[model samples]
Target: MTSILQVLIDAFALGSLYALSALAIGLVFGIMRLINFAQGDLITIGGYALIVPSSQMVAELFIGDWPWVAMVPAIVAICVAAALLTERIAFRPIRDADPATLLITSFAVSFFIQNLILLVYTGRPKAAGIFPGLSQSVTLAEGLTVPGIQLVTSAVAIVLLAGLAFFLKRTRTGTEMRAVAEDFTMARLLGVRSNRVIMLAFALAGALAGTVAVLLVAQTGVLDFRMGVFLAVYAFFATVLGGMNSLVGAAVGGYVVGGLSVVLQAFLPDDLRPYRDAFLFGIVILLLLWRPQGLVVGKAGRERV
Candidate 1:
């Protein structure tokens, strides 16, 4: 039916955003073996970076026709810097520490960033000021309408995913990154600079998070300081469902989660709507129990030091 197709489009659009965000999380985990809880906040950072500049109508100062391109670079740069700084300040010292310590530190860093934003920007939601054409709907089939922005978002996500695949497969730095993931000590012995590689990982993750933020703003048209909190949960779930260290797995997991969410929303009765997240959470719990490493195989032959 047309309605079903519409739902599928909606799900894929949302899932693409999730895929990018999850890729950010997965990238950090793949290299440093640390979950950057602040990953979601990097998204929040990207959102606000645009919100603040556009709110002032500052885009008018730049080229009117393609102001968005400028915003994209500026926002992504700010987010990448924030991510790198967070890693250096909060994560680098604890790099060799136990997983528990890293996790707690991540949580703490997340809270610190969120609260800092809240204090500076207030807790109110602000419109993200996306391009005008983004919200336009297109008739894909009889009785089916899909948002123009959603299509663009999905296309962008696919392109970025493909580009990422190419980078990981063909580049020397990418090979070194994979080598580091497989065996950090051996990678170090091979003259792989752990510091530089890890920083690059964080940068890539930041760029992905920034892109997701732009897509999210395009879809929702508004953002709140607390937006990062729920997104973090979603990203964590995607990471669990996909293989934690596999980029492709993260993308697949994101779409799967998005599809499952659409299916549930479409079929769930009114009474169960409120508890949908609870059910999904239960599913994540089960998935983690069954395959703690995630659905896809992570970095091949990882050994705990």
Candidate 2:
């Protein structure tokens, strides 16, 4: 029972990271219907943003003897900038293309960004400035163990998800965002600044990915050049499973995939672990076959204005 409980707790934590990445994917798809393959590279960008800073100001606050209130703003600012720049440079030019063309362009952008990173930074992994306590575990009553970082990750994820839900449902910008998502050309024709909304979407993606970068770096205590590739693939699967156009669906899909992956690893035999991807792919195939639209294809229709 303790083992099962531990698995469940761990799954929740892992799910949070997946959900954050998936949220970015879902948002872009919702607005443009274009799969931004470059989304994952932004994660690498976020990781590098947190890594290459020589001052270590944010790192100091996280590890400081005093409260860490100031770190939040700094982190948010860096992430938002990274996101907006990515949009301005990579996505803006291809805005008018068909889905296939945009997707290919996204792939090209992903490689170009990654190569730029490779040219600038060593291909080696670097240690994050976080404390060693992040990986430490605590045992609850009846011998269930949980990692401290996991709890922190889960808390941040829950807060972000709640705030995003509120932003989408209550704000005027959110209403305009929805309008753009429903029909970008029509929305533009109706006086909505589609470019601005699209850029905002990219900014949001960067912010979310940046948050995930910090969490991942904090949890793993290492930063690598190639970290984003794996995460991007996971986010892709999660978004597809949940529903590309549905933010809620992406969040749910992320957790589901995370939980299932962890549980399978924990319970499956050694030989079977190698087949995990195949099993997961099979599940996704089954889901798609069963429900072509996805778990919850948001309420927004695809009609152009």
Candidate 3:
């Protein structure tokens, strides 16, 4: 029973991180009909923002040294700025382009940021000591122990999810965003400013990415240029699996993917452990085949033109 409880806790914690990543991707997809693959790089940038730029392998703490109160917001702000800048410079001009073009543009932006990181930080991984204390194990029972970071991650996910729900349902700007997501043309006709809503979506997505970066750094204690790649990929999968058009579906898909990952890791044999992701993806593929629309279907489909 204790072992089962431990697994559940671990799964929830891991799922929380994936959920945030999914939410970030889903937000942009909802508003722009463009999957911003560069979001992963934005997350990478967020992690890199904490340390002073150096070619050396060891990272020096810059923002990481600040008090949590200030450090968190600083990281989030930097990511938001980066997201908005990309929207203005790389995406806005081509806003009406084909979805394929927008996708390729995202890839271009992603690679550009990645190479830029390599130039500044070099190809080596850097050791980051962001909130090292969170790495410690917390005892919940005689035999059940969970990492402090796991608890914090889950708590943060819950708070952010609730806060986002309230914002979307209650605020004027949030309603405008929802309208825009449902039908960009109609929203514009209704006086919803496209640029404003799109920019806000990017900002919110970036904030989520920044938060993930912080949690990831705290969890891993290392920095790599590709740190956000797999997370973003998984989140993308979660978004699709949950239903691309529904934010709630995206969030739910994140937990499902996260839970599956943990369960596979725990149950797979030693020889098969290396192929856990392969198996998990296979399951996801089957699920998608069974229900192509995803776990949750959106009420109305909007054509992007």
Which candidate model has the greater lDDT, 1 or 3? 3
Pick by lDDT: which candidate is best? 3
lDDT by residue for model 1 (1-305), tens? 77778888878987888788888888898888888788888898888776443564332222213378787888788889999998899999989999889989989988998898777677777765577788889887778888899899999999999999899889999999989988889999999999999999999988887888777877787878877667777877887798876777888888878777777887789999888888777777787799877787754623431
Candidate 3: regions farther than 4 A off:
54-58, 302-305
lDDT of 1 at 64: 19
Worst 10 residues of 3 by lDDT: 296-305
Angstrom error of the Cα, residue 117, model 2: value is 1.6
TM-score of each: 0.91, 0.90, 0.97
Tell me the tens digit of each residue's lDDT in model 3 across 1-305. 89889888988999999999999999999999999899898899999999986465556788999999999999999999999999999999999999999999999999999999998888899888788889899999999989999999999999999999999989999999999888889999998999999999999999999999999999998899999988999999999999898899999999999999998998799999999999999999998999888898764442421
**Candidate 2 residues 1-305, lDDT tens each?**
88898889888999999999999988888888878878788777766665443343222223222233654445656768867886788678877888999888888888887888776666767665554587888777668778888989999999999999899889988888988887677888989988888888888888888788878877886767778778888888989888877899999999988998888889888999999878877877898899777787776632321
Model 1 off-target regions past 4 Å?
53-66, 288-292, 299-305
Model 2 lDDT at residue 1? 88
How accurate locally, in lDDT, is each candidate? 0.81, 0.79, 0.92
| RMSD to true structure for each model, in Å | 3.0, 3.5, 1.8
